[model samples]
Target: MAKTIFITGASRGFGKLWAEALLQRGDKVVATARDLSTLDDLVNKYGDNILPLQLDVNDRAADFAAISKAKEHFGSIDVLINNAGYGLFGSIEETTEQEAREQMETNFFGLLWLSQAVLPVMREQGQGHIIQLSSVLGLVTLPVLGIYNASKFAVEGLSETLAAEVKGFGINVSLIEPNGFATDWAGASAAQTTAMPEYDAVRAAFQAGLTDDIFGVPEATTDAVLKLIDSENPPLRLFLGKYAQPWVKQTYEGRAAEWDSWSEIANAAHGK
Candidate 1:
C-alpha cells in the first residue's frame, strides 16, 4: 500500500533523503520546510506525489494548518516523520539561556505540538505511524553538545511514553536514533554558541577526532527508516549507524551496573 507520509524539515539532510526515497518508491509525501523554495527540487522531481509546504515546526498554528492541509489533500496521513530539529553545539555553561530554550522549543516542544496535532487524525483513522528522528546522543551524552543532548534525551523519554500510549489506538511510534551521518546536520544545519575560552581545548579535541568514515551515508539511514516503515511490528527504538548499537548497548550496561551497585540502598529507601 502507498502511504501518505508527512515529513517535517524536508528541505535537507535526513528529512530530504527520506522524502526523496519514499517518493521514488511511489509513496505520497507531504514534505514541509521553513522555506518552500528549498523543496523545489523535490516538487519538480516527484510532481503531484510531493506536496511541499512552508512550515516552521516551532509554530503551533502552522503545524496544525499544515496537518489540516495534508489531511485534506491526501485524505489521511498514514505516517508522520518528525525530523524538524537542529543541533545546538556548546557546553551547558557556554550556551545561553535563550539558546537552550530555543533548542528545546524546536527539538522537543515542536515535536510534541506536531504530534498532538496529528494524534487526532490518527486516532480517528485507527492506524498510523509516528517516527521521531532522535539521536544516539539521546542514550548517551558527550562534551560540547550538552544542550543538544538534553533535547534528544527529552525526545527519547517522550517517544517511549508515546509509543506505549498510542499502541492501543493502532498507532505505532518509533524513534530513529542515528549516530553521526554525512549530512549538513553538523555543518549548515547546526547552530553554535560563541566559544568559551575554558572550553576551547576540549572542543578542538572533539572536532579533531572526527573522521570521514565515522559518518555514514544518508542512504543507510533511509534504508533503516524504510525497513521500519515496512515492518509489521517495528521496534520502539531503532538505532541507526555502525556505532549506534554498541554505543547504546554500552550505555545501558553501564546504567544497569550502576543501578545494581546501588539496588540495596535504592530498595531500602522505597520500603522504609
Candidate 2:
C-alpha cells in the first residue's frame, strides 16, 4: 500500500536516501530539513509526491507546526521517520556544556517533541509507524563519541518505552541502530569540539580502526529501512549493517556479565 511518510533531516544522508527510496516506491513523502532549498532535486524529480519544507527540529514550535502541516497536507502521516540529528564528536570532558545541551536538544528532545505532536493524529487513525534513527553507539560506548552516545542512549530508552505505551493504539515504534555508514555523518554532518593534545593518540588509533570504509554502504541501509517499514510485525529495535549484530552482542554480553557478578549484592539491597 502506498503510504504518506514524513521524514526529518531529509536533505542528505540516510534521511535523504530513505525519502528518495520511498518516493520511488510510490509513497508520498513530506521531506524536511533546516534549509528547504537543498531539497530542490527531490521536488523536481518526484514532483507533487514530495513536499519539501524548511524545519529546524530544535525549535519545538516548528516541530509541531511541521507535523500539523504534514498531516493537513497528506491527510494522515502513516510513517514518521525521526532522523534529524547530528553526531557530536568529542570526549565527554572535551565537549562543552552548551555542546552537550545542543546535542540532546536535537537528538533527543526534538524526537520527543515531534513524536508527541504526531501521537494524537496516529491515535485517532489507529495505525502508524514511528522509526527512530539511532546508532550502534546507542547500545555501546565509543571513546570520542561520548556525548553523541549519551544522546542516542536516551533515544533508545525513550523509543523503547514509547513502543510499549503506544502499541495498544496500533502505533508501532522502532529504532534503527546502524554501525558506521557511508553518510556525511562523520564529515559534513558531524560537529567536533576543540581537539585536546592528550587524546590525540587515542583519536588517531580509533580513526585508523574505522570499519566505515568496508561496511558503510547507504543502499544497504535503505534496504533495511524499507524492510522494517514493510514488516507486518516490526521489531522494536532493528540493527542494520553486518557489524551492528556482533558489536551489539558483545556489548550485551559484557553488560550481562557485570550484572550477573553483582546480582547477589543487588538482590540483597532489596531487603530479601
C-alpha TM-score for every candidate: 0.97, 0.97
lDDT of 2 by residue, 1-272 (tens): 99999999999999999999999999999999988888999999999999888999989998899999998998989999999999998777788989999999999999999999999999999999999999999999889999899999999999999999999999999999998888888899999989888889879987888854545788877787888998889999998888888988988999999999999999999994
Clashes of each: 0, 0
List clashing residue pairs in candidate 2. none
* Candidate 1: tens digits of C-alpha lDDT, residues 18-112: 99999999999999998899899888898999988999899999899999999999999999999999999888888898999999999999999
Measure candidate 2: CA RMSD: 1.1
lDDT of each: 0.93, 0.92
- lDDT winner: 1
